[model samples]
Target: MCVRYLGFVLLVWFTGVLRAQSAALHCGAPSLSGGYLVPEQETYSHESELTYACDNGRKPAVEGWWATSTCQNGKWSHEPQCIDEKACIPPTIPNAKYTEKLNGWYEEGHKIRITCDEGYEQKDQDATAECINGIWTSVPVCERSTQACGEPPKIPHAVIIHQEYQEVFAVDSELQYECEDGYTVEEADGKKSIFCIAGSWTKGPTCRIRPGTGLGGSTVGGTHGGHTTSTGSGTQPASGGGGIRPGTGLGGSTVGGTHGGHTTSTGSGTQPASGGGGTGPLTRHVSNCGKPPIVPNGEVLETNRLFLKYRCGTFYKLMGPETVVCYSDGTWSEVPTCRVAYCAVDTDEYPDLKHAGVKYIKDGESLRFECVDLWLVTNYSEGRCTDGRMTFTRCCNKFQLNTNIC
Candidate 1:
């Protein structure tokens, strides 16, 4: 008797272990390029689906900006990929302008027409300017007319890049300039652009020494307390030093810096430290939830920093609230579950039941069952499905009229 009891206990324990393992099945995180998946997580439960959003000028391999993938037993049903949409940036032609309004970036195979300025003509009238594979092809060139502006003026500390050899430049012709080492053009963002006007070229920008060098009179250092200070009260440096004019600071550098740093310097001459490397202010958390939680067999319909709405898949009923609120601590309200809304029956167990081979009966739908030739059932002929379950009033064999055989 004791041996039989021990054997039964072992069998029950093994079944419980197997049930736990099957219930906890999950898939590892999936990776995507040129885009990111929503509701990112380290692991996802079985049969869970996720949607991804692509970056600009790129689309998922499947279709539009958004695509979905499902996590099967241990692998992804579809691997997500974001591919280049093959869009081209607007092309610039010297002494000419596009006829249509430039829409920033043009899709593949898009074409644009150029109209030369008053005193210029296209070098190749038959050339077609079109976008192909994210590049412009056969761009029209506007040749200079007899009545044109003189050669472009040379800047003191700058040189032309990819300068085309031309004796004369037409009105509205433009050129790109690059400043020498240790020097930067005034108000120029990396490239110095100059264009010809009615009869003369635009004023060329001057390049001055870059700040933060130990050789120049300007000194940039961090204080003992780990804060950077840029003072502009000192006298101007000699012509060799690349200091700013009387009261200006380095272009684009903000005083005090970002990430909660504070600036104490006065006057417009003050600026942030070079490279923004010095230690600054303490960081603080923002009151916002970056991503919403993933819902199996469901999707997020509306999303915001503090709230979101969820919807379940077809034939699945939601068991909790449709909307969830995010707290300041970044935790969300109780998430809902998408409960199955269909009833399934075993065909092998009830061969006499009519349509027992049917896959499933949707919620609120009815199904009829039959017994064997000599057996009869009362109130078990028709049953309605509900919430993954089905009920019948009675089940009995022909001889056991008063007993429920099932």
Candidate 2:
């Protein structure tokens, strides 16, 4: 160490001598922190160069951990500095500016708030970003005012009718909703539109079962919100649309009776309707959609004023819509077809086989078997089921003698 120090002193002395010869042309030693320079000297000649290295976990303020600086006309070409390697540089965001003071190098866990320029909007809830472990969190995006709202929120029992879903929506954009089978908007006459305003969507309607109807139109003796009254009893119309009439028969002809004046007591037709005993004209709801269309081999699982859900019978599968809707034009939606399905294997014909008992095997399914007795020839058999038919590949005899057959 002493030898190296003495050689460094000699080099400094020689540099001083050269500086004295051309005092105006020589450059003074450059200043550096958190690092050390090579060829330690008090002064350097014009056009002289030196390299610098930073301490551990630090790097030169320029490009890399080590850098070179040139002395020209008594000044260094680049200033040398050793900065923390974990320091974060400010991010550049288009159309956005930091609200707080920005530093050249920020230590870990630093935070900054940003604001969008005029005519632009922030895309995140909080317009702030934090630096952790030398890395900055995702910065909020600043988009034009036109792209203010994100994708529309989902509602219950309904789907937005969009050709393709989008991540963002422009202000004042409109979206429509289609209720699921057996459901309709609560407000039957109201529009089914949802609009994007500012950065949110307008309140949308709820999808509820249509009034005055049940699944498959099976519910009976129900009233239509007091709009109508039962027959044989003296009662005033709730809406004052009509008055009560006198009963001609002993029980005041069943409410909603046919024109012939014969009342059938089946009890299934006791639906909400306006009927009176007198000989006056009976008025029905002009917009009331009648019973749904019948589906062959398909029973109604759910029914409403304008919707019906049908389910296929056992061993039958539905090929089309399970639920049909009644449009405003008094037309019922297309009814689905019930096609026969071969989902089980028939074992009645194979009495001599080991699997004589009945067992259900779906189409395109199979079972494998081997000889039960080792004394008999080792034979394998497979029963493959397809379209209600099972193919028997081989059979083994239960007894090794003539009494047994395979």
Scored by TM-score, the top model is: 2
Candidate 1 has an lDDT of: 0.60
lDDT of 2: 0.60
In candidate 1, which residue pairs clash? none
Lowest-scoring 10 consecutive residues by lDDT in candidate 1?
234-243
Q: 1-406 in candidate 1: lDDT tens per residue?
A: 9999999999999999988777567777777888998789998899998889889878765544598998888677767767677866567788788855333456688898887765565673433698888678889987755335677777877888887766677655688888888887654234377665444454455677777644344332222112223345521122122223345553222223243332223444433243544452322121233345666556788775346789876556788999887532235677887776767654346644532223346788875555443443333345568766776534444344335344
Model 1: residues >4 Å from true position, as ranges?
1-287, 304-306, 355-358, 369-380, 393-406
List the candidates' TM-scores in order: 0.24, 0.25
Least well predicted 10-residue stretch by lDDT in candidate 2: 260-269
